[model samples]
Target: MAQAAAHTDTQQHPIRLYLVVWGWLFILSACSYLVDYFGLAGYPRWSLILLFMMLKAGLIVAVFMHMAWERLALTYAILVPPLVLMVFVGIMVLEANYTLFSRLAFFVAGS
Candidate 1:
């Protein structure tokens, strides 16, 4: 059985790239704050928040976590589960709403 060798590549990434990513993270964070400060209401606000959150998470995972240089199998292994989880979460939300509505309709409030 052949054992997998680790750390074979000695290629060092540029410091400037990390610094730039850091800057973008800071900027996105500020935007997230501004969204709250401006008091954005309803779905649009949550949509923007989720967008920035995902973007920052992706950036951090891709660069600082070194996932971008990782193997394809490893990359998909790490990323795909969360996508499945997100789908489940959406289904759960819909079920929760339906459950609440059914309960409200089926049972009367005590007077």
Candidate 2:
């Protein structure tokens, strides 16, 4: 049917966009590795690493997954889970510092 053909065309547009996005993602990853291997970054090493990772993730989500076109509720569903895990990571880091410092203080007091 003509409607089915039109529907197929609409689907193809996003697929094409996704393919292009993936191509750029591959290029970015390759370039990031080259930069890292060449030791071109003058600042903190993790800064470049995290920047590339975030950029790659953003492109993957925005173009490949089409999260940029999604509704707010759907976007929140995708984004919130990782944010919860990040909060848990932060809490764990704080707890680790607290425990380590407490043990050190106890050792000092006992001595």
Number of backbone collisions per candidate, in order?
A: 0, 0
lDDT of 1 by residue, 19-56 (tens): 99999999999999999999998998999999999999
Worst 10 residues of 2 by lDDT: 9-18
TM-score of each: 0.79, 0.71
Candidate 2 wrong stretches, greater than 4 Å: 1-23, 40-43, 108-111
Please give the lDDT score for candidate 2: 0.84
What is each predicted model's overall lDDT from 0 to 1? 0.93, 0.84
lDDT of candidate 1 at residue 29, scale 0 to 100: 98
**Native-to-model Cα distance after best TM-score fit, residue 45 in candidate 1, in Å:** 2.7
Question: Distance (Å) between predicted and true CA of 34, model 1?
Answer: 1.5
Question: Which one wins on lDDT?
Answer: 1
Candidate 2 C-alpha lDDT tens digits along 8-89: 7764455777688888888879867977788775675667777888899999888768888889999999999999999999
